[model samples]
Target: MSLRVAYGARRLFVYLVALVTFGAASPALAKEFHVLAFGDSLTAGYGLPRGQGFAPQLEDALRRNGVRAHVTDAGVSGNTVGQGRARLKWTLDGLKKKPDLAIVALGGNDMLRGLPPAQTRADMDAILAEFKRREIPVLVAGMLAPPNLGPRFGAEFNSIFPDVARKYGAALYPFFLANVAGVRALNLPDGVHPNFQGIKRMVSGILPSVTQALNAVEA
Candidate 1:
């Protein structure tokens, strides 16, 4: 072949190689991120259909927003912060792969039970410490106590989540059931948990925080 044609072909090959290399290094390159939604019945979907739970809905929302993530539901009904701490290791051990992000949605049951705020915080701290030790990014979802629980108890109980998140540098979703909490129509018959419509609203409110947590993991 002519030297001119040979040199031109070589240049083309080099350019293609460089392009491929850059593309591989680009952050925009899609990556599959695994997220574990760890919490109580709220995360588990409770009385709703299997597909209608918070994890499934959140996964759909994440995908819709172009995040390549699989959100695993690790919720157990009636799990308090203490119970969550106890089972955390087993839960993590059972995962096929370590999750890039974990969302802690506990404390609802703790609040309902009128558990001591200090004990609840301690349990949460332990949970957060474990995640931090494993270098797993966490997004803590806070739960508020009912007003009937009294202002002093409510304030102390409600502050546990944010305090822990602040201490551990985890992301905080100020209130997991923000838009759905007080709305009578959104709750189940028991009025303590969310119904289908309530779950949707909760998912929507938490999406931004979840997305932020995902970004932290990627970063």
Candidate 2:
């Protein structure tokens, strides 16, 4: 079977199981604003407990401010931009309904792995294109390469966000880890993933962009 067909099938299987599991709750969830958090360990809430992940925390923050959102955590730990591209289609296909907004917060792992910024740019471009094709609004929340990687690497990596966001005319959140990245108190023991406080800081930083994107979606 073609890769597309295989992925579509997997999505269908996922939809069936999700249907069974969230049967009664599905309709209510459907009524809420839907946003998809698509990225890496950060979005997946790597080290922190289940409820403290980026998606959940962000959703809570949004709702508190009266956004009434339901954010889906589609992040997979250790996933690169390439992996994100490969799964993009099926991830949307499996959504019970297409998200009103998709937060593209990837490229961190790519930086960590020293993957070419060109490759990251390409994958991000494709993902943004697909979102546009499906009429899904995108919110590009970018990650900066560690400064130790050198100014050249940081330049290329940091440019990926504005470049892609402008290319797609999507909303942009300059840094996904804005206030928490180097805050030792906000990070986990590994100093990579954020602790709850860090996640809160992240949510606070990203919330305005999210609110703006959501407003656009509603419009």
Candidate 3:
């Protein structure tokens, strides 16, 4: 082959090789992680603006802590664990990218509806199992049943989350409403859901746990 032709062919080969390398490294090259905030009205930011929801606020908090992550709000108002499981696949399909970490903040609606504790646990177990099967790290956000639900019911409902976390080796954020539970200023007129300020407190209280969950994913 002529010298000029040989030089041109060699340069083309090098370009092709570089392009292939870049393609192979693309996934790891993307530094931002995705966190799917999967839950009920609490995660959905019921009665609040889209930008002020728990997911966005939590995303902001994550950024402040030097973690590059986008929190996808997957909350549906008045959803029970059964409902969440029924719609889980549809929700996953809607995501542009599968989440690296998922905060499973559900079951409160089940408690409110007086669903069987065993049923609630079973549904949650299935959800957690699905996440594990997909190799997605999960942080189970627990909820305490109202005292009016009876002591036995409260204990059973609250125990489901921690038990599932332990079984699946997932992170646990006990009591999703920890800081704003009885705080009158934090709740809305219903006394169940938190108001705007209460939501901020909720985000702050759960930030550490969510951060820890993200660290697990990084590890």
Q: Which stretches in model 3 have alpha-carbon errors above 4 Å?
A: 1-30
Using TM-score, rank the candidates from best to worst.
1, 2, 3
Error of 3 at 16 (Å): 29
Candidate 3 on 1-219: residue-level lDDT in tens? 999999999999999999999988766546798999999999999988768889999999888887788999999999999999999888888889999999999988898889999999999999999999888899988998888989999889889999999999999988999979889999888888888898899999989988787767766
Lowest-sum lDDT 10-residue window in model 2: 24-33
Tens digits of lDDT, candidate 1, 114-189: 8899999999999999999999999999988888999999989988988999999999998898988778999988
- Per-model C-alpha lDDT, please? 0.91, 0.91, 0.90
Q: Tens digits of per-residue lDDT for model 2 on 61-156?
A: 998997788899999999999999999999999999789999998988999889999999999999999999999999999888888999999999
Q: For every candidate structure, what is the RMSD over all alpha carbons to the true structure, in angstroms?
A: 3.3, 15.4, 6.7
The candidate 3 region of ten consecutive residues with least summed lDDT is 23-32
Clashing pairs in 1: none
lDDT of 3 at 174: 89
Give candidate 2 regions above 4 Å deviation: 1-31
Q: Report lDDT (Cα) of residue 125, candidate 3.
A: 95
**Candidate scoring better on TM-score of 1 and 2:** 1
